[model samples]
Target: MKFFNKTGKLAIGSRLRMLTEKITEDAANIYKLYDIELQPKWFPVFYVLSQGEAKIVTDIAKEIGHSHPSVSKIVSEMAKQGLITEKKDKADGRRNMVTLSPKGKMIAEKIKDQYADVNAAIEQLTAQTENDLWKAIEEWEFLLEQKSLLTRVGEQRKNREGSYVQIIDYIPTHREAFKNLNEQWISQWFKMEEADYKALDNPQGYILDKGGYILVALYNNQPVGVCALIKMNDPVYDYELAKMAVSPTAQGKSIGWLLGNAIIEKARSLGAGKIYLESNTILKPAVNLYHKLGFQKVGGRPSPYERSNIQMELIIKSSPFQKTAE
Candidate 1:
């Protein structure tokens, strides 16, 4: 406790692990009191099997959010202890289906009463605290999912090493770097359509000459990232933020964030009210970056690209780009 107090937030992982170890120790005693021969670590797999459905290791792992090997290890232990039965799946020969044994079913029935008592005890324990730890943990999980600790630390690292990065207006030399960067990431995930080639082949003719603007991110005088503000003919949005790409060698350095904020500021300077973009949900990191740039999802518009499954827009009139993570 004293070490944790001194270490403060740096000991979060250790603190949470210490709490789990304590709970597990108490749980072992509780299982002994109930006379159930079950391992505390096997409870999740056991509970899943007790629901009356035979599941393969993959399905059990997905449902419980554990790994395939982790669930398989517990299932093997349970089978060895005569608490569960494992058989080859009828639908798939490569998979093994697992279910509770008769002894396991009897223990499951006995555990029902124990489950109720433990729930009541936990409720009483939580009621003694000022805040609900269960709700806090849920929120913490959600926030972590949105932005991981590694990403947060990377942003700080970017700020510290940002002197080498420069955001400047597009130049003729960046044309090839821009197209190649976009093509590299696109081909890895989705095919580049005709629209991509038209712009990537000639940014000046397809975008800039049409009243659009492009920005390039240079790391140590070498172009590594690019973003385009395509002038849109739509009434609601003034520009379509498109052709954003960062080289694989330059990723995780917050180049995307810097380029995105620079583009938003460029849009504002051009008197733009709103900006629109199309993206696929499978590009999770890109979508998360757009969300960080204050983009909100919208619908009812057809896309020019087959890979576009989701659409997002950002109102730039009132929303000033704030580098929140940095």
Candidate 2:
């Protein structure tokens, strides 16, 4: 009986380890085929060195989300392979600076070429299904992020309950709630014509179809705010955030901030490099929110709508608030 139990557990553990080993073996094969010497552990270190100066081992560990001891072991292995060298930091005796050696630079250059090749191979493999696959992945990732945020917010509220809210995806059921909120916003700020308001209301019609999204804020299960993203056709920028609205009752409670930030986070997660929004001077609070979120004024462009107004753009990739949103 004891032998049988031990055999059963060993079998299960062996199968799990075998699966993990297979994945590592496949990745190693790819690296070998591409003549790339850097393994998963070495890639980040090589990436940092390729960027500029030798980084402290602790900094490398932080950037790669690894323990210092783990990074040190990898670095030591890399040094043995003549891929990296460690030097003492002059100012800090405790820290060691890690730099790539000449052979490491050669391998890094080959890795860059292989990176493009691997992407091309993937593109070829998914040529027929890439669009749908990417869309599903994006939506799944977005929903996961929202769920994660809800959990974090819920935990925080338990400790110190505040005026926090989590808005989920916008679907047909929430259409009327979002429309009413937008109508109130237009009435107060833009004095937008019925047609203009109508166009904005059907965000799906205007822009939400092209990797765009609509999310509605809920308080006690009642929709009180809305935000939408529009993928830009610009060759330079990837997308823009637009159609942000919050009901007057929810105005001062930072609902707008939450909506704006959610849109930005979703955009960044979808690989958008920058995001811009149009607004008028009358909406000072909205503009202030944008500024607080690191948006800066850009040269005014003609509005698509005759209502025409001021435009502000945020370089999402460079914004300091990116990680917080993530």
lDDT of 2 by residue, 1-326 (tens): 46546788546546657766986787688898877776865666678777768998788889977798888888899999998878888998887888888888787777777789777976886786636665775796788677875575566654442255777898878778767777777777556775456446676676666667888888767888888787778875677676678777765567777788788888877778788787877778888999988788888886765554778888866346656666
1-326 per-residue lDDT for model 1 (tens digits): 89998999988999999999999999999999999899899999999999999999999999999999999899989999999998899988888889999999999999998999999999999999999999999999899999998888777787876767899999898899999999999999989999999999999999999999999999988999999999999979899999999989988778899999999999987778899999899999999999999999998497789989999999986444443422
TM-score for all models, in order of appearance: 0.55, 0.46
Q: Which candidate is the best by TM-score?
A: 1
Report the poorest 10 consecutive residues by lDDT, candidate 2. 155-164
Residue 284 C-alpha lDDT in model 2 = 84
TM-score of candidate 2 against the unseen true structure: 0.46
Model 1 residue runs over 4 Å out of place are 160-326
